[model samples]
Target chain A: MTRMNERLKKIIIIVVGLLMILLMAISFGGRERITAVESQLGSFIAPVQRFFSQIGNFMDEKTEPIINVLNYKSLNESLAKENEMLKAQVVSLTMAQKDFEELNDLKQSLHYVERSDQDNYISCSVIAKDIGNWFNMFTIDAGTEQGVTKNSTVINGNGLVGLVYEVGSNWSKVISIIDHKSSVGFEMLRVTDDYDGILSGTTNYELVGELYDTQANVHVNDYIVTSGLGMYPKGILIGQIYELVDDRDLFLKQIKVKPAVDFKKLNKVMVIPYDEYEEEITTYLP
Target chain B: MNKIFVFLMAIANFILMSTLFQQFRVYGVLANLCIVFSIIFAILFSEQHGYIFAIVSGLLQDTFLGKVLFVNTIIYIILIYVTVRIEKIMFKGNDLTPIFLISMATIAYHLIFFVFMFLLQSTIPIHQLLMHVIIEVILNSVIGLFIYRVVFKNVFGYKLGDYNA
Candidate 1:
């Protein structure tokens, strides 16, 4: 009788676990806001994560020179080899700078505004990163208290990083563009015409894009930016196309892209509060 | 008292894994200290205690990540259950038990997580998942052995492989 009771208890536990999994699977699509309990728990844990993160950074900074010194012979050889290549690269870069300046002047005259220029950015330090590689997500120190809200665009100096999905009092969870579940509306930044496309992340931490027009003229090294049709704002640099995929469908022009942000090294990010630019962003549509 | 200490350590390990251990990724996969801790704690303590630790740690992870809730809880529960079952068959205090169990548990964890994501219609490359499991198994085994010995020694007041002593 006692053994039967134990078996019944095990069955009950299994049923409860299955129910929870089923509920989570059903609600997987729409992750608008996290529960208050989750938010509070995250808020409680953020400070401790921040403390440990800082200590890790401090230890890395202190040990880097020692590591460098230990590898001084190899480092010196590499530096000498790089110096020769840099000398030739600098001359070409100087020439390119002249052309860049001309383009900048022309852009300024045309009153071309960049999405990043809008001043609703709240800078925050990364406290914790997603423990698993399945999702490229992180928690930042800034939250609703610091003007960060759900669906806000997160960017580093390089470019579009991700979007904030959950917010607490002083912390927010950011899902990066490289996460498999994340998708962005992007457009090719061509001089003649722009072709809209949808870019989604892959499990291998890479971006893949599909253009709406099958006959679009796309080539390697073409620049891609956010199309302002989704959670991200307009004109934010997403990445550049690297390789084109041969798809048998013939209706979608698919290509592989290299992301602008180095997700592995993310430390600090600026959040563009979605509500602050809601009105201005809506004007971009239609 | 032991349960409370173990619970606190779980939280501390979670913070360390998501913060410090994140920097030391080998081939884009970091060793999940929470998994290692849960497996080792389950082996050291009673099966009932193991389930309790799994629930707490798993909930803490899902709460902190703010993703599909209870995903980790379900995975960890399965892991603890499997570990407890295997413990009954093998030498309970054997040193190789945890190394083997952790390796298997890590693979199971990823496979279960992949299944969950696939059910949600997330696209995960099979090769990428394989690579993640392979690297994580190696990492978790090495790290899990160390954590196992530490917990075993501290809780039982003797080193592993010296159960009679």
Candidate 2:
């Protein structure tokens, strides 16, 4: 009986081990499917995310006043500067709105192309940071309840922040461009023309890009923007080229960029709820 | 009771490490206090207990990171096994040995982690990698010493001779 029990225990352990291995393999192999499942799961847990976000907001409310009280003079000066900036932004936006109205005629002429580019965006505040060391992910106070979904492009007022990798009912996880696995299609906005490239993150807090051999005419301080790829909309500011390193052996040039958005100080973000050129970009990739 | 307490403490330690300690990055190198604790715990406890703690710790790490699921489990298990085996041989409860062991283990863990990351085609620079290892070693050792004094000595009533006897 003892020997039989020992054999049964061994069998159970082996079965469990095999099951674990199989699960891991499936998780890695069917990554897209797993991601889809995670997004689906997000819809179910949106309310929980909302509750957490509310808690975070409550904490912030309680802490902010105390912090301000301790440093009132500095806080006042900072608030005044921020107010001035906000006024300037409002003025620019008002002018842009007017220009948008005037360009309605031109827009009608390019209706077919412009129609697809139109999208709805929702703004949400950062609720929490994801608990991890490897990936730079954060949870935001928006979810499927607010129409946020997986693969949604998230950005701050300044520039791109990241993309929604996973979403819960009221919260979503954003995989920042700083994450090692993240890749973005980018372009250089020069005075004359736009050149395309692929942006990747490095160990340092810098976004770097590898330009195509033909369109390698990039210089330091050149503005980088998201290419009008299916994943991201066109003309969105990415960063400025800080350095250009030439790889003689590979005949390739690497452009280091300082992202316009400071992720460390991120408070609120806008989620582009729809993919503008999804079909076109998917067709281009394998 | 002891098992439940240890498990809860490990979870709490993980939560604090991920959320609180993350804000205190020095020149882009963060302290891995959890890893240090795992090592110390494995060294102080029985081999079976160490193995169990390692698995729990790894699962806690995986849940937080959302990537590299089994990597932590496998690594921690190996680390605990090695630490326990070394403890059995050396059989000492000295201050210097714990510090040295922690420093070595911390460096080893970072190196092994870097190699795995490299295999996965991560883009971490060599200089930053070295800096991370050094910083983690120093921080973990300092923190390990304090934990040893407080938890093992004061709370648990563990002495250097506990292992041998």
Candidate 3:
């Protein structure tokens, strides 16, 4: 009986091991696509994740004030003395603000903001994020509850963050532009005549892109903004060209970009409420 | 009672690491608490317990963030197996044994993850990725030292030599 049981255990272990490998191959190897039904079943985890995410957010919220108090405890004594020291500094800061506004105007940012119409944006907090060192994916607190749909353009004060990919009742998953699958259409705002390019994120958390034509003069720190061809709103700043690399494609000038938004410290974002999509219809030429 | 405590602690750790830890980065690399827990389990518990935790935690991670399924699951399984194998052959009853194993596991887990990611997306730079994996390994190892001491030695009262084969 003992020998028979031992044989049976070994066989069972072998079968299970094979099944695990098969599952891994199917998923990671991308051999067979996960069916929609299976995907929907997988999404059943959303609510549970949302619950834990809320618990985490609650803890953070409760802890932030205490932390702030501890940090500012020493600062409190120096406040009055610092206030006297900072009075003249305020005038310099005001002048700096004016200079910043002038710079913004030079970039035609006001025009971009006017065209983009920020009124329809829904404010949301990040409740959870991708469970890895890669901050390429995350979840937001607002979802269908706040009328957030898939593919909404997500942004923060820094620049374009990413787009919503999946949505549930109260939460949604956001795939940042740094993810390998993400791509964005952008134009150089510094070049008024504007060179265009398509930007894609790499596994190394960097954005690499190619301009439509190499004729346009590209410089370091020249800002790139969305071209507004797709779901993205017009002129949303993506990032600045960090370096000009060798063009791999004959049709485009390859370049590297430094994304404006800090992917790691993202806490809040605004999702533009737009569901614009093009569906072309055709008929057989009878 | 210990099993229940471990299960709850795992859940709490998962939630904290996935969400709250984003705001608190150490040297631009987020500490992977899931990998840390699974390594500890593989070193301290029986194989069955270690395997179960690995799968459960791996599935949660995949379901929430994974575009392709079973990637995290397979990685966790690989890490656990490596951890178990290392534990059997290493010198036990040392203060640094768990820390050393955790560091090895961290490196192995990330190396495998990067290898798979490179297969999926061929654009990843090898040297740049190695730097990232190294940073994470060092960060996780430093954290594992304190965490193991508290959770293993003080809380669980686990001996320095608790490897079950």
DockQ for every model, please.
0.61, 0.20, 0.34
How does each model score on TM-score? 0.84, 0.73, 0.71
TM-score of chain A of each: 0.76, 0.67, 0.61
What DockQ class does candidate 2 belong to? incorrect
Provide the clash count, candidate 3: 0
Q: Could you give candidate 3's per-residue lDDT for residues A1-286 as a string of tens digits?
A: 9799757856765676567556655654222223554346444545565566566666767877887887686788689777886898799879989998898797795465332325657898776787676447887777677888777889998889898876666666778998766889988875248788889887565799888877768888777888776667677888878898865557567889999887766777898765655421211110
Give per-residue CA lDDT, model 2, range A1-286, as digits (tens): 9799757855754675456445544443113323444455444434444455555555655766775786888878999998998899799889988988879877778774544443467898775554434457776768778988778888888888888865555656677887766889987665467678899876567887888864467778777888866477667788988888988787778889999888666667899864444443311110
Clash pairs, model 3 backbone: none
lDDT of each: 0.81, 0.66, 0.70
Least well predicted 10-residue stretch by lDDT in candidate 1 chain B: B60-69
Tens-digit lDDT track of model 1 for B17-44 = 8888876888888888777877777777
lDDT (0-100) at residue A228 of candidate 3?
A: 75
For model 3, the DockQ equals 0.34
Candidate closest to the true structure, highest lDDT: 1
Q: Is the docking of candidate 3 incorrect, acceptable, medium or high quality?
A: acceptable
Q: Please give the distance, in angstroms, between residue B164's alpha carbon in candidate 1 and its true position after superposition.
A: 8.1
How far in Å is the alpha carbon of A176 misplaced in model 1?
Answer: 0.5
Best by DockQ: 1
iRMS of each prediction: 1.8, 4.8, 3.8
Model 1 fnat value: 0.62
- TM-score, cand. 1: 0.84
